[model samples]
Target: MTARADHLVGVLGGMGPAATADFYARLIQHTPASRDQEHLRVVIWADPTVPDRVSAVLEGTDGPYPAMLAGARRLCELGVTVAAMPCNTAHVFLPRLVADTGLPFVDMIEETVGALTRAGTAPRAVGLLGTRGIVHSRLYQDRLRAAGIRPVEPGPEVQAEVDAAIRAVKRGELATAGDHAVAAVRRLAGGTVDAVVLACTELPVALRDSDRAGLPLLVDPTEQLAVAVVTTCLGAEAHRAG
Candidate 1:
């Protein structure tokens, strides 16, 4: 499956550097490529210095929009036709970013919800595990409701665990982060939800196979976004080839 020469995928990342790297790895893993040449061209603009998206969304702090828009412009200058932001919280600014750059973006939130609705036995109620910004902004909640799926959120205490897990991942504490994230998942699973969405990019990094065992079905939005990006860059037929 040869990659399309006219297509280049852009990654607007670095909201947290590890999540960006994880997303790129997933992009490679999902690409239907047995050889290097079959892989799509990708340009990543990762700037960790961008202001905090959670603060912008939750606390009325300075926005990360300027920095994000700058990254999109850079991808555009580099001839990238499509873009994706791995950080779930960063997507709060997605609409404006697309409008300003005229660069189409793969919406992680939409892809995540679409995956659930398309599942063999679509989940009637799904638990959401994301940052406070994504939760507060109703990013996943709104989409899940529109898709006719009930959205379940963790209580404040459980959300604190999620927040701690995200922070732990940023600080390079995978084991500790996994503990916190798994604890949160266990709490959410105790509720009536059938599956859980690891809505935050970092949550996927924090959760391990052992952690997921015996837990409710977990959806990784980063993986969903990666598959979508591969399809977008390679076309549906080529994407299915590998």
Candidate 2:
């Protein structure tokens, strides 16, 4: 497939720098490109200065909309055809971002739920592991319910562990992060959940395959978002060709 010069992917990231970097890597890894010329154009605005999303959602303090909007606007100015955010917690403000910027963005949360529904014999219940903000906002829960799948969330203790994993990743402590993430997954697996969604992008980076042994199936939202981005960009090219 030939790359389209007209299409550019904008990543509004740096909710935590590591997760954003991971998402970009996944995007490149998943793209159907044989040579450098076959790759899609991408612009990334990674500003770690964005206020804390967790504090905003959990405590009602620190609004990140302005910083996020600024990033989105910058991407728009760069001529991005479509945008995506890697952070799950930041999605709480996605509606306002899209409305304010009038820029099309691939919804990571929606894409994740859609992926689950499309899977043959969708799991009756799925575990959610992410920042306290996303879990409290019920972003995944509401969408999963809409898709006729139950969303199982970690308890306070497990959620704390999940938070620790995120922090570890941000600190560049992969080993510690993996330990925390695996512990949370193991705890969630004891429940009736058929699969666990790594709702936080950092969780996927932290949790390795060796750590996943005997744990329930894990879903990575970053992976879903990458696939959605590739499809959105390449699909648009195909549509234009037709």
Candidate 3:
């Protein structure tokens, strides 16, 4: 019998260093294996130096594309079977990265929406909490609309606070960041939205476990991406082992 090949998953991270670490943690948490060898192999190229994605997309400035491409290329060179990136804002330039690297990337945005559908929790409207660039880019808006869910965004005043929360996470201020995130969630919840999406990687860091219990359920793109990464890679490993 021809044996299936073991698959390796590559992560292009470090849009924000803290977010990258959190993504790895979530990946570990979601894996079904109990032993070290039973886990999926992951190669992480964490380049916190990747220029800010928000500024690049909005201000017409040089963004993290080149750095991200370099990381993707390195993973390709290492023979990773599939690639995933943790940052939502970085996804704005994903097409460029895919064209440059020729690697199959697991789409975090698509996966998140799919997750909601599979969970049977398709809400009429989902509140979005992320960087201004993601909102202005309309990345999530169009997708959510297609999924039969309206995308509700924070008002300018609340978005400013959301931005502050993201920045605080980057600065390693978890407590203050959590407060900001909770405030943003409260505002979005007030609109009678069913759920909130922590569309930005940094936003997830701002939310504590206890805080998540109180707030409306958050649809986490990072966690969604992690789940996809684990499922795909481990499924491949199982086929190979068999």
Q: Which is the leading candidate under lDDT?
A: 2
Q: Over the stretch 1-242, how does candidate 2's per-residue lDDT look in tens digits?
A: 43465788999999889988999988888777769988889999999999999989998764888899899999999988978999999999999889999888999999999999999989999999999999999999999999999999899989989999999999999999999999999998889999999999899989853356798988889999988888888875432110
Model with the higher TM-score, candidate 1 or 2: 1
TM-score of each: 0.95, 0.94, 0.92
After best superposition, candidate 1 residue 16: deviation in angstroms?
Answer: 0.9
Give Cα distance to truth, residue 80, candidate 2, Å.
Answer: 0.6
Tell me which residue pairs clash in candidate 1: none
Candidate lDDT scores, in order, read 0.88, 0.89, 0.84
Candidate 2, residue 195: CA error in Å?
A: 0.5
> Model 2, stretches more than 4 Å misplaced?
1-3, 236-242
- Worst 10 contiguous positions by lDDT, candidate 3: 233-242
lDDT of 1: 0.88
lDDT of 2 at 86: 96
Off by over 4 Å in 1: 1-3, 238-242
